[model samples]
Target: MSQGYAIELYFDPALENQVLKAWNVLARRQISTQLIEIEARPHITLLSSPSLEPLKLEGVVRAFAARQEPVPLSFFAVGSFPVDNNVLFLAPKANMALLQLHSQLCDAMRKEGVDVGEEFRPESWTPYCTVAQDVPKTRMAEGFCVLRDLKLPVTGYGVDIGLVEFPPVREVFSYVLGNPVEG
Candidate 1:
């Protein structure tokens, strides 16, 4: 657990709660509790890099956040990174608005001398909010079964953006976007 940092887009509470529900189910069943243990809120990581400097990047994130509108997202499918550690996630429907937002954020970071690398670049990014991580290979199907019980297509807007440092997660900064959270 290295002290890595990320710029994340957080959901409005409604959407956040829905994502939490998936996490809760997995935890209750002993399937996965990685996010719960880390106390991570439901967020789509916009960019991640260890080279991030919180003090210098605050203004960059705030200014970039101010320039943007809330990005509408529909988590229409459930999937995972086909990687060794086994991550399960809710896949947001990729739309031009989301891609452009990611591109602009990356461009802003580059201007500040932070290269977010190829994985986060708009052309290669697959936008998903993680639900469970580090499940055993044999239990992957059980995790999927629990997630399938979730309502498909959790729809909402990403309303806030922030920077967090983690191992033990900590919020460095956050700014609500142009479209505010609706009750």
Candidate 2:
């Protein structure tokens, strides 16, 4: 375990269940079960850094969350990062609202003297919700085939934000951005 934290945007319950179905399917097939093993929630990470101190970060997040409203999300495609370790993800359409929320959260974290990761910077971010990670190159093709048949264009609202720690994944705190209307 390491002292790391991330700011995560989570969708409403129904959307979360839909995503969970994919996670469960992948886990059962023995493709990649790292996420479920670690017990991570379905979320888009806004910013993450091991240097972040939770005490200071929580206030900024609570205040920021209070000021924001539900973020509309559309997961239009399955995506992945090009690295040997690999990551399979759900790609949310980077609409104006989602971009602004990401920007504001980054700025807030910075103002609180938190060191934000450069890759999470607004201009650099590629808003995605991870599905499976640490998948072997040999099996990635199978992972894709599994997910491709699942679905795309999942629409929902990002209703909550949280501060989380990893290596078994613990949620320090979470707040509802606003009242999200369930579809």
Candidate 3:
């Protein structure tokens, strides 16, 4: 059975290593990712929708990824919003580049006959990479503590994009942004 699909933003491996370090700390604290339920990776979720046909999804992703440039992102703070701010996450500061890519991708997906979900639309999206979800309120402070000294306000480029299935996310295709990183 195919897991549902989502459009996710993946960063350069170096930056991903940093985020995973924080996630490992969270897991050690006994904070469970029970809600998300997969051996999750660190990523910024751009869209989550029911599973689309693999070939169609791949074609859309290829076209979308090819025309898109790498998006620069800044993680400003650790935050939460799982069914009443219950999940803990890394919050990226909102910027025009991120917003525009989201809008464009959603539009393109819709035109390609994919029913892009409403929650992922430009009006309702809240961009974040979850660290842990479904934690007890009593442990919220502890969760934040795990990420406290993680080089906050970090800057990185979203260098890769993928279309994936959720619950147990499996990637259909991933496209690396071909733009060069500036020194």
Return the candidate ranking by lDDT, descending: 1, 2, 3
lDDT (tens digit, per residue) of candidate 1 on 1-183 = 557899999998899999999999999999999999989989999999877899999887888888899999999888988799999999998898888889999999989999877889888887889999999899899999999989898999999999999878888889988633333
User: What would the TM-score be for candidate 1 when compared with the true structure?
Assistant: 0.94
Indicate the residue-level lDDT of 176 in model 3.
79
Query: How accurate locally, in lDDT, is each candidate?
Result: 0.90, 0.88, 0.79
- Per-residue C-alpha lDDT of model 2 across residues 21-116, encoded as one tens digit per residue: 999999999999999988899999999888778887777788788889999999989888988778998898999999999999988878887767
Cα error, residue 167 of model 3, in Å, equals 2.5
Model 2 TM-score, all chains together: 0.94
Better of 1 and 2 by lDDT: 1
Clash totals, every prediction: 0, 0, 1
Each candidate: RMSD = 3.2, 3.5, 3.9
Candidate 3 lDDT tens digits, 72-132: 8888899876586578889988899989988998898888877777788899988998877
Candidate maximizing lDDT: 1
Please give each candidate's TM-score: 0.94, 0.94, 0.88
